[model samples]
Target: MKVKIDLEKCYKAGECYYNHPELFKMGEDGFPVVLHEEISDESLIKHANEAIEVCPAVAISLED
Candidate 1:
């Protein structure tokens, strides 16, 4: 699975990082930065889902 975030739709709200600090990091610019493009950890699916659900800008996406 892979995760993608739309910068145009994102507002840098930091929800993704808040939900999954181990996976998402706050970039110097304050946006949620993906540690990796590919999601291999099955345990993190729920966290990713939470991030998508809580994102105010609705920018987070998952691809299988």
Candidate 2:
């Protein structure tokens, strides 16, 4: 899976970070900073899906 976050669509809600800190981190400005953009592992997909669900800005996305 490939993951991406649109900065223009992000409003610094930080839910994505909270849901998947291993791959998503909150910057000093409180916006999400993508730590990993390409995900091939099965375990991380679970967190990625949850992050997508909790992101208020809807900035997180996953592509197969």
Candidate 2: the clashing residue pairs are none
User: How does residue 36 of candidate 2 score in lDDT?
Assistant: 76
RMSD of each: 1.1, 1.4
In candidate 2, what are the lDDT values of residues 1-64, reduced to their tens digit? 8888889999987788876789888888887888876888888988888888888888888987
Highest-scoring model, TM-score: 1
Model 2: number of backbone collisions: 0
- Cα error of candidate 2 at position 25, Å: 0.8
By summed lDDT, the worst window of 10 consecutive residues in model 2 runs over: 12-21
- Which residue runs of candidate 2 sit more than 4 Å off their true CA positions? none
lDDT of 2 at 40: 86
TM-score attained by model 2? 0.83
Candidate 1, 1-64: lDDT as tens digits: 7778899999888888977897799999988788877887877777788888989999998899
Q: lDDT (CA) for every model shown?
A: 0.84, 0.84
lDDT of 1 at 29: 92
TM-score versus the correct structure, for each prediction: 0.87, 0.83
